[model samples]
Target: MTKDTRKTEYGNESISSLKGADRVRLRPGVIFGSDGLDGCQHSFFEILSNSIDEAREGHGNVIEVTRFTDHSIMVQDWGRGLPVDYNTKEERYNWELVYCELYAGGKYQNNSGENYEYSLGLNGLGACATQYSSEYFDVTVFRDGYKYRLHFEKGENIGGLSKEKCKYEQTSTIQKWKPDIQVFTDISIPLEYFQTVLKKQAVVNAGLRFILKDEESGETFVYCYENGIVDYIKEITREDGFTEIQFYETSTKGRDREDKPEYKVKMQIAFCFNNHTNLLEYYHNSSFLEYGGAPDKAVKNALVYEIDKCIKNRGKYNKDEAKITFADIEDSLILVVNSFSTVTSYENQTKKSITNRFIQEAMTDFLKQQLEIYFIENKIESDKIVEQILVNKRSRETAEKTRINIKKKLSGSVDISNRVKKFVDCRTKDLLKREIYI
Candidate 1:
């Protein structure tokens, strides 16, 4: 065999090929699903997700985001900071390894109840990829009476992780970086967009303080909620006339894994029908699900099922009109669903969808039970809702009948002599210039 062919056969382009940082640097889209401003904004989310993960794990309660005049962004959190120990094999600080290496994090095996059960940075590429895609990244960690700092430029360590003795008592982490425009099309963080993201995070976290400041304008905004998603729903639907806000929350035991305790799935949902608009927002493990997934479908199913039951129990609809479609129920529906599970399977690296079917079934059953009880207890409100459903059905039927009548009139037998007279009397027969009414 030829030398090149023998080398190819022996796997010459294997482990000795490309490094992780190089791979990530070349393909920023793989980490964020875009290489434009949207992906650059996602890098901020990747870093912010770390802070939220800490809060989710019962660590700190305060997170601060600052936009500097130098076009740089910094995120600071009062959580357990990154470790500063030295790795004997790599001969580098643990914090350095976190940024300089890929697939290295404390989330590999759930840490046997010591670490987070549900988090956004489970893939171990959050901070590393952020660093690899940035022109300059700096991290500071203060833990246990010591302060550590690590700085990097384009994924290369500038001065390495440095440690110093300090009298600090609280553990904290600060990450600041500038996005590489060559790698990303734009990194300008939209203040309003980020405000919405942080607001949603605060609503989910409940009592976790999120402070955002613009250094240039001196404008600051703080977001913190004590009642969680319920408060969020009320605030959003305050202007609209809502019937009632239905809330259902539960924690169910999931199947056990090898040597791990039974996984627990925590879910909370709030939905209401207002007289104004329809909105549905879903989240999993503190990450927003823009495209929606099984859980969303489950909620929709439960809603339709419960409404149909209500209609039947009230004797409002006959056998022919018993069916209630999603469009009918979705009008003026405002819903917020939050779910967390130790074991969750998202569709892709973007984590925009939850692909687990078990979640759907569980959510459907849970909501169905809650709604059944609610309907039984709140008969008056239930009757009013069913009335609205019937009204929607009538309106739809009337519209359909009108449309059919119009179609029949247009398709019915016509007089050819009358048509010919109309066309001939027309001043212009040019389709573009002529106007006709039938």
Candidate 2:
């Protein structure tokens, strides 16, 4: 065999590392999970999450989001402005850390409640990652009775941090950035995404006001839920639910394992049985849990157990009937769960779900106890809930049976004697001669 001319030398120089902005700009998918519109949308969420965390800490009550005609997005919060000055311990300017460095943030020590007890921007990568992925980013912070400003382009700081004295009453932080088209294939985030996200934040945060301004459409909208998920449920059911809404909330401390450090978790649940509408939403640390790993499992287990027990005790089930499933309860149930924990185990950077064993156990036990007490205190409401769930279960079973029978009949060999109406059979086996009629 001839010597291989194509064989290239493999040496230490072959290994390389991405630094600073290149880490996110070169591989946007690695950080944001996509290089498409989804990633672009997530970048927007990162900035909004920071604002939400600040507001949750009682630093602010209102957050304003603006979508300019040029597609640049701005998030303004009336909170204690971000720290951008020099850090004595880190020996670096916070502006550089927050706007340029990845994995440098204030939330890393959240478990100790040093900065925040519960927060949405737990990864410490949102601010920097978004900045790196943006074409141009600008930050204006009002704190310490002064104004601080920073600007960046393509992940590189410009003119450094600017400080000036200003007569401002409330401390605030305003960020404006345009998602880079080079980094993200598409950055045209729709207006509906902002509306939906702001609404969700308002629902989970309670009493927090979100103002959305759309420059393209010249429209402004506000979203706030004074009673959080409970008010949201009322809005969805419109007083037409078969049973009255029930709200339960509790706080507890626990750990995933014996050796793990203990942490606090706060859980809120609001639900009602409605024949005409149904919804199930789970949120952890103000981030919407689309997959709902822990909370979903807990909700399913507790609701099914309590409802099934109620059915058996009330003689609502037929003899030898199968137990009720979560689907049965879910069919007529409209529930919203908002939970917060000092330590959260997000499955990934996208934060669509959480997998905290302690949170799951705490929620399941609390929900079971609250449901048991509710059933005992409100007999009529519990009866209505049980009856509706049974009706849904029966309806679903009947539908499944009908579907199976139809599928079986359709799968059978074609018989001219029992031909379907208006369906004519072709006489020839030739491919070109076969025809179908409507």
Candidate 3:
């Protein structure tokens, strides 16, 4: 349907008609992506991603994702399990809503939301889509001193959940389940994909250790990045050899004169340079907002201002023709950005890319002020970086001229650059396609 075709204002008739399971189909595209194997993997992403969020919350430090020969995928997390409550008045477990209903999660309403305040689950259909998309699905949660199981097939419920002996201690629940073959069109579960995803999560999330054990295949893989995004910076920049892996980390908590203690921010920036051409850069949290957002606008201005002062002080650039490019600043440069908060949305993961501040100008300001201090104090590194920046400037100028010449040859004016939105980039934007492409 064209964007103009759908009614702008629809009634809630279908909304109520949608049984919890049926609700999943009206927007199955919203959950599964394109009704393909990749979408099946996304079903796994939702569960596994939630576990990763648990790790981010400091409730636990391990995540386990296992794929069996039957193409049945099971993610066992060492983190806290889902809430399994026996509604005394209702006489049934709330797992039905937790698993099959949309917007029925602890993350909703921010009640006891100390952990998942920044959760992607707040998107609200985590288990809702899991059940509708799977032919056979079972959720085993160990929480609040109980082990509970909720089973489903296709989109229909089979009845009430059964309480079982908890395998996990009161602290953490052990789990294992099979995503039925009928619903998951893809029969092949690649070990590399699992490894890569888990590794990325380990590096991005930092201290968590995720383990994978396939009983049928009798294979096991473990991933835990002690250094977190710092190691991730190394992995990406390994292509280039960086000199001096200087790192600094500091966390701030409590009210910022706003009298709200829950507002917390953790920052980590690591700077290094390598031999390769590209400045390998990775950012988590709000630092990435500088990628052309309001925050980026602020930071770009501040960065240029700060660097210009430094250059003038050092008396490095006497020519007005010289220019400073982010690329130049990043030449052979490796920078890592890490931020955390109790209230934030990472676009789709627990990465915390956006904050309640809405306008991330403050994040940019924080980065610029702190980095300026860092560059000033570490002049040896600053000099090295400045030299690298000059080289980058020369290269960028050359590339710009080359591009302009190429464009001029083709047409008087050419599209400077083309960028696709995150939604469009993913094969299926129907489901939450906000995933790490790499």
**Could you tell me every candidate's TM-score relative to the true structure?**
0.86, 0.92, 0.74
Q: lDDT of all predictions, in order shown? A: 0.83, 0.93, 0.62
**Candidate 1 C-alpha lDDT tens digits along 247-360:** 889988654344655566889999877767778999999889998897889988998999898887778886676487877877767899999887777887678998766778
For model 2, residues 139-252, the per-residue Cα lDDT tens digits are 999999889999999999999989999989899999999999999999999999999999999999999999999999999999999999999999999968988889999999
Q: Which prediction has the highest lDDT against the true structure?
A: 2
The better candidate by lDDT, 1 or 2, is 2
Off by over 4 Å in 3: 1-18, 32-34, 88-92, 109-120, 143-146, 165-189, 214-218, 235-243, 250-262, 277-305, 345-359, 402-438
Instruction: Look at candidate 3 and tell me the lDDT of residue 327.
Output: 54
How many clashing pairs does model 2 include?
0
- What's the count of clashing pairs in each model shown? 0, 0, 3
Model 3 agreement with the true structure over 1-438: per-residue lDDT tens digits: 557665656666545555656555454545666455566666666777667667667787877777777777777776767766666654656776666666665675442454474344566676667767666777777776677777677777686777766555545543334544555556365777777667766766777888977666698888877887667667766656545666766665543336644555555656567757444333443223323333344445555667767777898885776657565665565665555555554444323234344335455666678768867888887787777777778878889899999978777453333333433334665667566653
